[model samples]
Target: MRAALAATGRVVRAETFRLLRKRRMYVLAALWWVVLPVLVLLLARVLQVTLTGSFVEGEAVSVKTLLQGLASPFGVARVGLVAPAYLSPSPYVIAVALLAAAGLGEPRTHRMWKSTLVAEPDRRAVLAGTFLTMQAFLGVLLAGAFVFGAAFGAIGTTFLPTAAEGAWGRLAGLYLLQWAHLATLLAFASLAIFVLRNVTLGVVTTFFLPPLVEGLYAVWRATAGFEPLNRFNALFQGLELQATLEAVPRWFLSNNLYLPARTSAAPLLDEVVGTLQAVGEEAGGGPGGAQIASLLGADLTLPHAGLVMAVYGAIFVTLLVVAFLRREVA
Candidate 1:
């Protein structure tokens, strides 16, 4: 037992070092830091111009308002994080697929499995170490995104909202839920790699299959009236959370779990829109209103989304581990 644990630790360490040494790690970092912030900045500017008709040089109120819209916990969780995390072909999903393929499938492609098996001996420990390394890498990526968002908020607003009152608890909950969602993505990608046993095939399938399946499922559900099929899709399950009806089944994977903050922010958004409309009316612009419902849709009180995502993640992990154990390295 002791030897197995020691071997697992060594494999984990080696895998971590290997991942960090990859050129793609630098590319991922650059996207998170440089590209994401610049995109946010451009989005803010566009919103400012649309809302207020002109960008005031000294006054950053428009920018701040736009930032508030984009940075709201609700918008960030649903549209920003959840959408990209679950939606197939997204940069986040593709990056995770690539990382998982490189981590687990590369050994097979490069014929390193025999030597690795020789070094570790125990296949379970080797698989466990790879899983741990992938989890660690994903955790770091999510943490880096959080830090970049904080920096972006600071740059856009004079006073970033502090964790006063119950804000800290809410923020913490949002982070945890988002982490859980991303972890599910990681497990799914790992499962694909283990099943395919080829790096390129695994990455391509993981990147493309979910969306294709989702599209087909959507058509079947609409045309065939098969609502139960919705549960099988992570993306569809997420969208169901936005349903306005009170009777929508409270699924464990709905986006509602992390978007309560968005509900609270709705009134503020309405007020901002009202203000913008008043200014526009005074300027002789045509009748216009900020469609809050269109922006955020209806808020549901389902708490089961987190639980569903957790269950799916466990299932994916279990399957991946089983496949890895049975796989012949030689």
Candidate 2:
């Protein structure tokens, strides 16, 4: 057992080295983690400013205030849209998938798997290594993106941003749920790559085609009046994370901040009330809904969302390991 763990560790280090050896990995990392996040925050801020005319609604609002409002549903300054776009599952997942396809797929295509197996010998270790490296790569990107996005969110405000409690835990759940979502799909994509030996085909089957086909099928299903919508909904599963992320943080902020409405000194501004009430209604929110918003993300509970997606991932990943062990390197 200890030996297997040690072997897995070594393989993980080796896989990490292989990924870092590719120059494009760094480029993609910067683009997705840094560039894309910053761009999204700036663009969201600009949209808010163009319409509302402030970095935050009040120039005097603290930097902490902006960070609080971020990832929350309040559109007072339109800061909350970043989380969904950051985790859009398509563009972002495709970026990571393209890397996985190009990096891992090409090695198989070139028949390098033969030499790799000869060197490592234990197929499970190699698989574990690749999986860990991908998640580690993604972890760095997720953490860096959140930090950069939060910092960027505070750019035009006055004081430093205050990060909050168990709130961080909720956001962590959001990102981890994203990790599971992407991890599941990427695992599926890797299986497809191994089976077909074509990165384009593999990724499209797992990532690209599912969403498109699902959308069309959903329309057809609606037209045909299908009863249950739960079947095969994994491909389109990030909204629960987005809604939960937005909902919980807003709860935290409302508790901590001194919005005039909270004090009954003033009613909610027309825009703020409209946006919150509209989105909250769908999330099962209403008067006093903000306090209980943490109960569910959008329409689904986290457990339901997690189970629905994780079950498929568990099956695909098990098959992936088995297939790798049986695969012919030559």
Candidate 3:
């Protein structure tokens, strides 16, 4: 078992490094993590300014107040670091999903699996590594980009972020929930890759099929007695199966979680959304920047949402492994 675990770890590390070796992945990572987040931040701050300016008729607005409100860069702990991305089937997920599914589409084209099997000889370990590597790659790309963007966004808004220990715990939980979400995506992407058996088709199906089905489901739900997929309705979806957040947790946007956490204990994290709507209401972040503050929250107060992802992750991962083991190599 120890040997198997080691082999899995090695495979995961190797697969992760293998993906990193691709130059385009970096470009895409930068586009989603750096460029997109910063762009979102700037636009958010601008919008805040525009709205605040338009609403205020005549009052001596303090510089301090302006500064306090200026750190509007989204998904940066002000609005639950995952909020902006959770708001839609973000390019971050799409790009990652496409890259993962596309490359692994058939695997026969790459023909690395036979060598991989010879080296590792454990199919389960191989599959586990592949799945984990996908998530790890996503996490590294996301966290790396987030660190830069958060630091840049932190300017002027903070005197010095001193996030509480509780805040760090909540943040860690939120990230765990986020990983569950990514796992669900990878499971589906895995299914798409193997089933479609073509890179282009896998990409198209993985990215596009969900939204198409969602539209039909929406109309059906609207028209009559549709209810099985009611969960999908509440969470907005577009382009495909990519889900949009219905209600994000309000974390109270303590700036410390955004900056100081990085310089200190790396494992501790902060919230992006509320663990539960009730919890969000209770935490009372007048500023509101919650994510999963507890295991109870896990991306949403809705057990249906969390449960769906969890169930889907399990089912799909199992299916993919069984399917992969059976797959014919050309």
Best by TM-score: 1
Candidate 1: deviation at residue 182, Å? 2.3
> TM-score for all predictions?
0.68, 0.65, 0.65
Superposed by TM-score, candidate 3 places the C-alpha of residue 20 at a distance from the truth, in angstroms, of 1.5
Clash count for each candidate, listed in order shown: 4, 1, 22
Which residues of candidate 3, in runs, are more than 4 Å off? 44-80, 83-89, 156-172, 226-302
Cα deviation of 327, candidate 2, in Å: 1.1
Please provide, for model 3 over 282-327, each residue's C-alpha lDDT reduced to its tens digit, 9 standing for 90 to 100: 8774223432332112322324455556666788778888887887
Candidate 1 residues 160-204, lDDT tens each? 322112243554455555655667777888888879877777787
Error of 1 at 158 (Å): 6.9
- What RMSD, rounded to one decimal, does every model reach? 9.0, 10.5, 10.8
Candidate lDDT (C-alpha), each: 0.61, 0.54, 0.54
Give the lDDT ranking, best first. Answer: 1, 2, 3
